[model samples]
Target: MSQNLLIVGAGEFADIAYEYFTVDSPYTVVGFAVEKDYLTEDEKFGLPVVALEDSVTRFDPAKTEAHVAITSTQLNRVRERLIKKTQDCGYTLANFISPRAMVWRTAKLGVNVFIFENNVVQHGVQIGDGCVLWSGNHVGHQSVIGDYCFLSSHVVISGYCKIGARCFLGVNSTLADSVTIGADIFVGMAAVINKSFEDAGLILNGHPAEASRVSAYRYFKLKAPT
Candidate 1:
């Protein structure tokens, strides 16, 4: 039986989630939900868009599951908050692991994970709740990805590494073996993290990644849309 799903977001990521879940997974995306203040349209992707505050009432958590499609905005605080709220509403979060992705049977994953096509998650890997692994990434053996992290396409996480909660690893970023990334860190696109990062809230960039003085908000230009 195909499960009904409610995606919580109306933006780009939500659209992508809808496409993947509908075409690749067994879940049928029934509708979308966002905060009432942020809702600009009544429907998206040919489905109804409900305010998140009333989502549980409309969809009924007993009949449908949810996935929060927000990215690592506000250093992932927004995603984390929304995820918690969804759980509090008694909705079981749905995980969408692409049929094309290669994930080891022994790999443990928490709820609401979105693993895209061509990704390889090796044995002993532990992925926390609400993490999104974009296309073509490779998570090596024994790696631990914390909750709510967003890893963009083609990122590589080497063996035994520990990625902290709410971190954003940009496209083509590579983390060396056994490296421990602190929470809320943002690694820029194509950056190579050869060493462990102990400090939180720093933006890392360049070939051999170095911490930048700018916060994630400034580095990613979150305050104003580009």
Candidate 2:
């Protein structure tokens, strides 16, 4: 029997999550939910769209699970906030691990993870809650990815590396072995990280990635909603 799932958000990521979970996982997506103010449609993907505040009552948290399908927008703060909100509503979060992902049996993953196709999570890897590993990424042995991190396509996390909470590793970025990345760091596309960075809230870029003067909020254009 498939478990019922209520996917939060009605954006592109939510649609992608719906497709992945429907085709690859054991969860059956029964509905979509978003903040009432953000809702513009009554239905999506043929599922009834409900306000997230009322989703618990409509979906029955005891029988249904939820997956927050928001992207790493706003330095991942938006996704993190919704994740916490859903958890507080008594819905256990669901993980969507693709059947095509080569996750070693020794790897540990927390709830609400979305690991896409061809992700190679090697032995002894620890992926924390609400992390999203896009397709074709490589997580090397014994690496630790902290909570709510977003690893984009083709990112390579070398062995024994520690990526801190709420970090965003862009496509094709490479982390050297044994490096420790501080919390809320943004590693830009194709950046090669060869050393440990302890400072948080940095926007790192370039071939050998260096901290940019721009904040993530400014670089990513993440302004508070008006």
Candidate 3:
């Protein structure tokens, strides 16, 4: 059963999401929806581009599904905001779990999730809404990834770990068992986390992954998540 789907952007990530939904999932991509300000083109990949606010009118929300096709810009706040926007606009959100990825039947995932190839989401994992698990990542058992988090390729999240909202785990980063990360934190590339970080907005980097002097919001030049 291929459901009609509307990807919520027309950028690079949107193109990737469209291809994945069209080829792998049971989704027939019907169109794209983005803000009018960023809607540069009238069409993308041969689909019509509608304003995000107007998507529900163009495509009946009950009949169509939407997935936010945004990346880790502004520490994933962009994706986070867009997900909320779509939900508020009365559209049913969609999830794209790759056929190639081995997602455990017991693992629970939220709406608009994009799980790429070669990822292992182990038993009892709870991945929140709008998260992106990029290719080749390993999520160990009972881990909790919060809403709008982005885990880059090959990152390793060990057993029983908890990650907070709008966080970005860089490529090849490693988290030890039972570790907890707070909201809006950025784990730099290849960093290793062995302990829990309770504080929010920290920029973590290095082998043992110490927090840098600069705040994550400041480093990203973002005011904060509104």
Best by TM-score: 3
Model 1: per-residue Cα lDDT at residue 126 = 100
What is the lDDT of every predicted structure here?
A: 0.89, 0.90, 0.90
Error of 2 at 136 (Å): 0.2
**lDDT for position 196 in model 2:** 86
Which tens-of-lDDT digit does each residue in 130-220 have in candidate 3? Answer: 9999999999999999999999999999999999998899889999999998998998888999988864546456778888788887888
**On residues 48-149, what C-alpha lDDT tens digit does candidate 2 reach at each position?**
999998888899999999999998987788899999999988999999999999999999999999999999999999999999999999999999999999
Candidate 1 — what's its lDDT?
0.89
Candidate 3 RMSD computed on C-alpha atoms after optimal superposition onto the true structure? 1.3
Q: Residue-wise lDDT of candidate 1 within 129-198, one digit each (tens)?
A: 9898989999999999999899989999999999988888988999999999877788889999988886
lDDT of 1 at 69: 93
TM-score of each: 0.92, 0.94, 0.96
Score candidate 3 by lDDT: 0.90
Which is better, 1 or 3, measured by TM-score? 3
Model 2 whole-model lDDT (C-alpha atoms): 0.90
